[model samples]
Target: MTVEYTDCITLSEETAELAEKELRENEATRRHGLQQVRDWIVKNPRIVHCRDDENFLLRFLRAKKFSAPMAEEALERYLLLRQSWAAAFNNMDCTLPNMKHLIDAGYLFAAPGRDKYGRRWIIARPGVFDPHKFTNEDMCRIHGLVYETLLEDSESQVRGFVHFADGAGVSFPHITLFTPKEAVRIVKNGERTLPMRHKQVYGINVHPSLKYVLDFGLSLISDKIRKRVKIYSSMEEASDEIDTNMLPKEYGGVIPMSEMIEKFKEELMAMRAKLLSHDEMKVRLEMFSEGARVGSVTALKQGSALTCGGRTLDTTLCGSFRKLEVD
Candidate 1:
């Protein structure tokens, strides 16, 4: 029979006593270590069932596997201490983490040290490491989302009204205008017609109460246009003053209303023109020849009851008109 050989492990009495004494003396440290581990586990509950702690212990053992048994035991204790520290902090709160809170707690510091691989560790405060910081792109996304939500909620307040028609003999629909600048092209059901492009016509007669709402909404979208928009009492009066002739040809301005109808015309010729055009083109042209004085013309039926005074003639003659081609 052959005796089996086995390795023997033994601890000296002095060594055992020293270990017990160290454990007793550092009881607070041990407790703190355990708490840290518990906090980490609480904070990262997903990692509780993971092999993280086991992996860390394995790594430590590989590096010091040939060390004394006591050294290995100390390493294990250190890992458990760190885990306790993390767990203690993790259990404090389940709400979203705040970098400011961590910094205020003095748990983090900008210390310079070597990492596990002897590489320089550029330590930074928790604020720098926080992943939830609002970036420029994030802010833009939030702004766009909010704007869309508001637009959808206020859809009823942004309605449109039709005011003018080009009558160009085209298949296009009559040009409609909205008091507010917001307008969109929509197709009717079962229709294959091309979508129409409608332009905003200024100086439209809007209800006083609606006017305030439109002004506020326009200001929210575009302050420049909102400031420039003007509201008038009547659409016809507004159209009559705005000199379509003064505008560039590209803007649909051609002849001035003042020059369109003759001051004195034979009844026969006036009747013939009206019959040929199927619409009366006569307009009474008012001119203020003297300084800020009222003037009137009754020869043409257009301005029979109207009066013009100080700078009104010029102001009316240079107004811009928006031409909308609706379909």
Candidate 2:
């Protein structure tokens, strides 16, 4: 009885710390949620065998609004999806030369400050996007850095986030040249894998000519996300959802977008070395005895499943990739 009491006290303390440290949920909810997810994690032999057991489980639980079953299914799909895209994902390095070119092109940046709900805001200006200059794979690497650096905050995980996908500068040529399939892959990757609350997506400054691209992209998202999406024909209308005071001057703020982006560039410049170091750590985990291994990326055609490092995943791939030669 004394030992059981001590165990209970220890569990309570750990749960309290979890609440304070990461989830920001109340202690009781944290304890219950963690236990539920933990048990769910243990039951899934695949999850138990994966290196992502530590963070992925909790991330999916919270992302799924703490439904253990849903989170489990989500985790399984996420693992299977990432494993399939070896060319795109294997040895992903944020500091790659291509990634730096995209950053310098002003493709992606975290708009400084939080939204009214204390949520982080990021604006991805794919308007300046040039297919000849980059590839779907490069965008994926940029997203890796975005999630690792900006969206990794425990608070952002709890409060959720909003993105201003400004496609004002994107022409019909840009859409056609890049291919809608690759576009879907880049957009949907966040939906399928990123571990955070995605509350709102504002399609600001969308050009009328590229409405087809918008329509096609919207078709890929579920009704839940579809309803949360608000498309604005003009920047003024989109401002209602964001605090303009927090945005760059281009979007109506005190500072210029160029200045904010330059500051972000400085931060990026410093991370080049760190991101490079991570490139060497990628491994075909299934070949390793103790390393956690998941199945590979399935082909998009709904054909046979793909296998990597002795693990096989039977899932349909949702996106297509183009083989482009980089300059």
Candidate 3:
């Protein structure tokens, strides 16, 4: 039987039990929390424009362990980061030629089935892409597209997911694709900015020379995120941490990578309109500025220091790559 793509994600009995136990999520709690966050959004005037629908708001709530206050903060940051970082968040249309090209290369894909632990696997193979043709920004956009699609499923939002960076054929050109600053910002944002319950990060088949550079990037992230990272010398070692059966055949699973890539492509095509609709979600910084009387729209556009909507924004809340992209 062929697996058809659908937005509704089903969790296994074990995974559902885990969610209730760990995430404090249940039918009753979910209903109450949804209303709580929804009401909070209505009361919070600074949160001007956003996808206030229950599905969208639930992502942040789940990521922040169902805490209304934390979810509000995260949702605000999510909007601010999208507004501030044009390179990554803007133009998230999946049908664009550039995005389709990246998808064709299997640059990054979330596998079809859940692992033994019921967590999703996002396999990233950077070496497959032509570094000369695509810049780091293109890669960032691809990541945005993949994660956006993945986050649609409640399983991914609650049970969380694991990232596998396959370094089988990574070369110097691939390494040079990212500057030191871009590398740091990417690491920082993955942990600090993006609202996802990222469980573990495992790297395998890594080249010896790139280990130091990867280590340097890892050091910039928080200790919690850093500790979730585990690098293995071979697939056998990685299998101890991950269920290889769910990965593509090339990586020791039964399914072909091409099959996963094609399925993912179809999924993206199916989700094109919804993904494009993300462009509609924007944060009216002016409303925030008016409330705080911090800056003008002109100042916000001019990249006023730590100001959004003319108000002082916590530097850490906003993932401005340029601000963090330094030696």
Candidate 4:
């Protein structure tokens, strides 16, 4: 049975129509797309212990607009990155003390409902996490847990999602949490490696230092994503573009941010088994070399390098890294 978490809203009929029109998804396409990707995964030796369930595979297909080839590539990258960046991606235990704290504090979470465009909202209060108390990986894991769980919803896969960063209380200390390499890696993964489709990013009352970081991130992402980034002087100004009621009361909505946070924590715990199961979804990189066959095409050739998180690593050495490689 598919497990569900609270506060993660379901798809409306209007949104379902939008998904069919925008994502090219329907009953027919879903079946054909699922089969194509499933066949490729079974044939590909490098992919082991990965869940090939219909719900899981559909995320890639929906994100790629039912294109099997693109979905296959995304699936490969998703598993491969999780294998390489085990520290940040693995052992996603939400019950841990720090992880629980971040959840209770509302550091990052999915809003209770969809926006006017049908896209879900993931609000981030970076200031809630004391830079001194948590490491960059901790922040990454929290986001990874939330998004991974969110992506399980079929509507999120099709409608995609937006990010809202409440920059109130953000300061230089939060800015210091990430080194240059770390910052670049996070942006790269969010844009390139992850399987979900990212629609837009909204930030209100952003800190000057964090804006510098945001600027740096802009340089790393594609022009399409760059154009979707919207920063406002205040939440009121942001409401012009975003529906106010969809936002938390702190941001001029009817719902309280604390209420959403508590619900998100319950959602996280509800999906705990599924989240922890990711520890077993690893890639056997030996099967990814030059001669290996992924369906009809070669996965990678000898001496060919894989560019991950803006860093290039020789394909032969990709499996050796047990953690995100720091340069």
Top-TM-score structure, candidate number: 4
Backbone clashes counted, model 2? 4
Q: After superposition, how far is residue 249 of candidate 1 from its true place, in Å?
A: 17
Off by over 4 Å in 2: 1-24, 35-56, 177-189, 262-327
In Å, residue 122's CA in model 2 sits off its true spot by 0.8
* Superposed Cα deviation of residue 91, candidate 4 (Å): 1.8
* Candidate with the larger lDDT of 2 and 3: 3
Would you give me the overall lDDT of model 1?
0.25
Model 1 over residues 1-327: C-alpha lDDT tens digits?
221111222223443233234233122433334334334333321122322232222222222222223223333223222233222212211122442233332212211222222221111112222224433222222222221221121110111111121211211111122122212111110011111111133444444545544455454533433454445565354556543333222224453222221211121233332222311112112221221111111111211222344332222221111111122
Between candidates 1 and 4, which one is better according to lDDT?
4
Better of 1 and 3 by TM-score: 3
Q: How does model 3 fare in lDDT?
A: 0.71
Identify the leading candidate in terms of lDDT: 4
Please give, for residues 150-185, the per-residue lDDT of candidate 3 as tens digits: 887766787788888888888888878777755765
lDDT of each residue in 207-275, candidate 4, tens digit only: 665677678778988898889988998877888787777778988889998898887777788888998
Give lDDT: candidate 3, residue 39: 71
Task: List ranges where model 4 is wrong by over 4 Å.
Answer: 1-13, 286-327
Q: Write candidate 2's Cα lDDT for 1-327 as tens digits.
A: 111121232223443344345544554554566666565444433332443332334567667666555555555545544554555554445456787677777788877667666677777888776777766666566766765565334456666777777777777656665455556655665675556677787778787777776788888777888898888888888777666776778778888887877787665656556544433333333432221222221212223333445565543221111111111
Off by over 4 Å in 1: 1-201, 245-327
Prediction RMSDs, each to the true structure: 41.5, 9.2, 7.1, 7.3
For model 2, the run of ten residues with the poorest summed lDDT = 318-327
